[model samples]
Target: MRILAVLLMLTMLPVASAKEPYKAKPGVAGNITSVGSDTLGNLMTFWADRFKGHYPHVTFQIQASGSSTAPSALTEGTANVGPMSRELKESELNYFASTHGYEPTVLVVAIDAIALFADLHNPIEGLSLPQIDAIFSITRYCGGEQPLRFWHQLGLEGQWANKRIQLFGRNSVSGTYGLFKQKALCNGDFLPTVNEQPGSASVVQSVAYSDGALGYAGFGYKIAGVKTLPVSPGDGPYVKPSMVNIASGDYPLSRFLYLVVNKPPGQALPLLEQEFIRFILSEEGQKLVERDGFIPIPERLIRRQLNKIAGDV
Candidate 1:
């Protein structure tokens, strides 16, 4: 009877000791605040809503005013997380370092390709980087190219030829605006005639409604009335801002989106903030990226991010 009981106990041990997959502990509930990047606002909202399902007691305060506002918010301690469509500038990092004595943690959350849009009826199919510079820059500083103010300069004819190119873009406060200036305009000043809208959706809408309008915006803002234009670097074949092209590095304007977190020296991320980052980098969370029209971070990158979060780097 003792030998039989030992055998049964040994059998039960295997079942009782089996390890389950790790899930984050629901630590103390608190409000998690995020700010910056109007371009990432919708994506952040989706994440916040879904995250609430797992952490029902936690609340979120998200502010997507613009990417330029993110660093300031972090410095002031108003935001715990900053979702930016572009990487933080060196000055912004320095500001955080000044206040907190450590640089903020940056997690690349998604991939984006900045798309150039034209009115749906426009027959022009593509533009080179220099040509984009000529269209949007006052000095045409990218290649010393001639300013292309009228559609006729681009080889249009008849009524289309006489029309002035209507320009639309995000305001200076926006990351999209900064990126377009850097990538397309070669960091030159925007042409004074260009209309600077407050957001990406507005840029899309402005171009969509105008007869000869052209604008730049993120791929997620692609709408029915505007057509995406393939773009070429000076030496390469033109590539559209599709997921495959962006992922393959064929798209010239592709960039990484980031989630910025403040962590002072010798400290770990707050419980709620760490859990939120874990969720955003998880497989289930990446599916939301695809659903929201952004490219999910690749598995290798995800692993790197997880290691960073774990302070293993």
Candidate 2:
């Protein structure tokens, strides 16, 4: 009870009290290793710190390389949890199942929008997905006629017109990179001119420093120097990546952040991983999602995720 009391006092997080508070169980001590998802790096740190609040003995080793690194780490038994901003690819899923002889347990922790950001100084309002393809993809696979190279091509006037539109983005290994390619670029290859950054924050930083730059990254990286652009699916009526729009599918670039655990069928999740997952689905955990500028999953979705790791915890 003392631990729970300390947690309540320490939780300055906002109320979304749909799911009950997670009651930390006994004997959950161990070093938990997590690998994957640069987009989820900070969120994983936040979760680890708060998780440690309950079990002071518990420690975490986190490696935020990219979502692609997650599967092999889990399959090799080197990591306890794999945080991914996107779903497991078929090959990854198959490999894990082939090695383990069972499918990995998946937990949906939060909702996130893959937002397109521009420099704060840019006055451009919104862009359609096809227009995005035209700007970022050399093939113009989304039915665009030609590459949009300058600010003038995007309808900016005065000094802005002559400014070249510099493109910044994540590298090939990133899930953000794959998803953006699939959705925004119509699964076409990125233009060779793109300046690929190592992480999402770097993409934001690159855009922040360039007056006519456009970049895409997780929406949670919003900062003073960059502004997230409202995006349209095809033609008109651009939708902002607001909580309401994301939940309603109006914002087309949304995804559920997932936690991949290798749990054999008819077996128990190791207690530490199990409890940490429970805490993530609890009221305090979802609050962290909102605190980090992402959308929280609804209580109903919370219950569904809880059921996946339920019997063991």
Candidate 3:
């Protein structure tokens, strides 16, 4: 009888109240809007869809005006974050310092290759840097450059003498155009009369549909009926732009994708953004990146990103 009484008294003690069940604080969810770089906007939309599976309450609005619009959107207070294909410019940095009182924080999200693709029917197999220089050079752009364009002209395999070379490319606003100009054009302007399509997909489509056509696009945008060319300088086996080659640094035209934020978002929204960025850097995320046809950043880059975030917070 005494033991039963002691147990009942202990259960009734004030300390017993400390073990109540956990009740979570209410979630303060809101929308976050981001815009920039059409080239990357498609990928970001895919990531946002996957993110929504975990966060049903949060809303993400994304748009792709161009890389040039990202910093302006951030400056105007319209977007919480911006996705970009290029680094911020000095003028953009100065504007941000004046308007937002701080420079935007730059975050790299992935590495991608810009590939030169041609109609599958074209006989020429590969291009050396010097040969490519000749092709893009205005002086040698004879109206007769076609299908084989001349094996001797390329110093490459399989020559047909009678075809005219057709060129397709992205509009001047595209980051792909900027990279292509820097890497392939050597700062020379694109050939006059070259067709300028609006997006990478269009460039792919045009090349796939036209005989004797050549174009450039993000490696991820490659499609059926077109052949990606292997490019190198001097004598080489040449290298195609693949995820492995890009991440491994064997592909020379690979470039980094970025997410630019003016300041760390506040507590509630920051958690979700942080989670999204974390997911992108995760094994699952990198796998998705490769599956979607872009290269994951190297492991060393991923670690460096995590460390930078840690330092920022």
Best by lDDT: 2
Which stretches in model 1 have alpha-carbon errors above 4 Å?
A: 1-24
> Could you tell which candidate, 1 or 3, scores higher by TM-score?
1
Model 2 is weakest, by summed lDDT over 10 consecutive residues, at 2-11
**Model 1: per-residue lDDT, tens digit, 111-168?**
7878999988888868899989999998677795588888889888887898989998
- The positional error of residue 204 in candidate 1, measured at the CA in angstroms, is 0.6
Error of 3 at 86 (Å): 2.4
The local distance difference test score of each candidate is 0.82, 0.85, 0.69
Off by over 4 Å in 2: 1-18, 311-313
* Ranking of candidates on lDDT, top first: 2, 1, 3
Q: What does candidate 3's lDDT look like per residue over 5-58, in tens digits?
A: 232233223331211221223352567688887778778887777766656777
| Candidate 3 wrongly placed segments (more than 4 Å) | 1-28, 137-152, 155-160, 234-237, 264-269
lDDT of 2 by residue, 1-313 (tens): 4321222232333444458877888888999999999999999999999999999999999999999999999999999899998878889989998998887887778878899999887889999998999999988888987789998998999989999889999998888998899889888999899999999999999999887899999989988988899998888789998888875556889777889998877676778888999998888888888888888776656766777786543
Instruction: State how far residue 40 of model 3 sits from its true place (Å).
Output: 1.5
Count of clashes, each model = 1, 0, 5
